[model samples]
Target: MRVRRCRESDVTTQIDAHQHYWDPARDDYGWLTPDLAALYRRFGPADLAPLRERAGVSRTVVVQAAATVDETRYLLALARDEASIAGVVGWVPMLLPDTPALIGELAAQPKFKGVRPMLQDLPDDNWIANPELAPAVDALIAHDLTFDALIFARHVAPLEIFATRFPKLRIVVDHGAKPSVRDGAAGWQPWADGIERLARLPNVHCKVSGLATEASHDWTEATLQPYVAHLLASFGAGRLMWGSDWPVLNLNGDYLQWHAVASELLGALPDAQRDAIFGANAAAFYRL
Candidate 1:
């Protein structure tokens, strides 16, 4: 398949819906070990500024890579000083008794647009569905904040139940539930069906990010087409947003490579629809 190269001029207001900036020295990122040399070091706004500039991404939503409230505060502080960081999806202990208070404090920050619980790392697949977390979830809706579900395929059914339970809470499924793209064609099943179900709910959205890390080491545009197609068909451009997944993306590819692949996958879309996935939808969804 001939892939379309993404030109920087294609979208006037490109926004990277998902990305991360972390300093391992902070000691909170448990997953940032030295063995994974590609991503073990610090990645800050200084590193991303050039890449974003080259990609024509005007603004970005920096997500929480660490699960601590301090890290959330860290990102919020970064957003305050960095004009390109449009929003910050920080972390909070949802099940704690004082979660509502924490949410209130975090939401007070203008750039704290949402919370992500890092559902993929949890042992329980149904963790998000626990009614015990209602207070935290309710606080999110009450404050008009969004939820970014960092989940795996197994968590999809539970996510559906969670979304149904809190219909008013705006949720965006990060990385399309991190599909088993490494398995190639055989990986498409339940993941695709599960995403389709989530899309049926009006409050749920999905990001076109992080697939490179989930795919085979030598992944190409063709390797990702079917999955991207399913997302486009399932959520439509209005609910599907583009994300860089950056530095971690360096594990498999670079920002420009993923951007070009995404452009090719979405090349057939109408200009308006393409623009929505590339920028407009995320800006509206995160209120950037």
Candidate 2:
């Protein structure tokens, strides 16, 4: 990746806050079905190297796309080997009795920064807030591991409850809380409201990622600006961070295309503030 030093004091380095790598042949990602043929094949560090370079991303946090602990282990191994991957957001069996042990084992590894439950796939929207999972959540807090909320807007209310229940636990809402951006203004309010409520918690952060894929086949900077603006207003640059959402982003837009769009959306902000959104906030949040 091309390195450009920013002169502004608050402006520092650029990091891709969120991205993923998957080996379908090695791991069973049920979501990686043939219907999504474009992403069905292997996506490793080499596959993402060019995209990161094209987008000028200096480092990245590789997140889990599968629910298995084995997948998390795979990512952790990659983080150890790949220079560009600064952190790994691995998965945990949230409902299992032995979750704390799983977290402890993974947390022993240097680059295992956080854990994410596939909340959107679970039938119960209230799962995160369930008291039965308190030990697991507490284990994450104890280990200083972040909780990556891989959820849809419907899961946001429960997420707020979870955040409130554990105030000091670091939480980041992945993919702008993944609103249905194709809905335009009429369908945007629920996600906007949820994000606003979640941001009220000092400990919660939001990712300005994955918007392009939520829209229909034809999405543009204009189509995504309103949602981006809402996140800026809700989270502020200090609490917000940028992510390519990469291979998934390929579903709607290329890596550089999304990067350019994100830059355009934040054009009004001062360079320092934009730097926080693009890089600093994530570095601080994930301890990269």
Candidate 3:
């Protein structure tokens, strides 16, 4: 990312804990094929420089966009030196029995704040709610690790059950349970209700990020309002957080667009509430 001169106050000391970074040349984003390249456009660390500079957000938590352990360590290394990247939510095989010991090993690294699994893409008949995996999911709470939930509409119901099973785990729901911006309000109530139910779990939180991308290829704040509003209402400021989801969001919107739309939707809140949603909540919850 390009770093320009900025006054001390312009540099936010708080966290912007959900941006993504990928070095295309280092390794191909196997999941994002050439066809998908058009969606991402010109995106990477460089694209976010001005957003950070303008927003005065110094620290951010980088999370896994692709499900892989290497992506986690890759970001952890960045957090080691880049003061702005204060935390990381990397991916791990949480379903495996050995996952707990592995997470314990990574927990030693201060920047490794959480882990995520892209559960939404799984087959409709998948078994994420199995009792066997409960132990590994529970291990995250024991280690004070934040578990970022990236699932789909149908997955929300099961997620609610999962939250009830682990009321103490710090679970951050990314993309507001990933509603379809293209889908009308009628198609999303089930997901919204499911998320609301999960928000009842004290340890659960919601991240206001990646909405522009989740919308249809063509989207506007109006298309995203219902989801964002519902999430804010359910989780409230205390349990809410904001993220750019950077490079990934390039699939549909840029940093400035994401920030501006969020500003319009969330501008009505008090400064304290804004601070909590934008950064403080994440800092307090993840202990960053």
**lDDT tens readout by residue for model 3, 1-288:** 222322343223545768887765545355765677754343445556678868667678887766778877877886787767778888888778799999998999988888887776666524567677787887788888878888776776677777778888788888787776676765686777787777788877888987777778778777888788888888887898888787777778777677667767777787777777777788987889
* Better model by TM-score: candidate 1 vs candidate 3: 1
Report the number of the highest-TM-score candidate: 1
Best by lDDT: 1
Q: Please give the TM-score that candidate 2 achieves against the real structure.
A: 0.94
Model 2: per-residue Cα lDDT at residue 131? 79
Residue-level lDDT tens digits of model 1 in 48-156: 8877877678899999999899999999998999999999999999999999999999889899999999998998888988999899999999999999999877888
Rank by TM-score (best first): 1, 2, 3
| Poorly placed runs, candidate 2 (over 4 Å) | 1-11
What does candidate 2's lDDT look like per residue over 1-288, in tens digits?
122323335346789999999988975698888799788888999998886776667799998999888898889888888999999998888768888988898889989999888788889898888978888888999998898898887887888889999998999999998998888777787787888889899999999999998998788888999899999999898999999898998888888888878877787798878899989899899988
Model 3 regions more than 4 Å off = 1-14, 26-28, 38-47, 124-126
On the 0 to 100 scale, the lDDT of residue 114 in model 3 is 81
Q: Which ten residues in a row have the lowest lDDT in candidate 2?
A: 1-10
* TM-score of predicted structure 1: 0.96
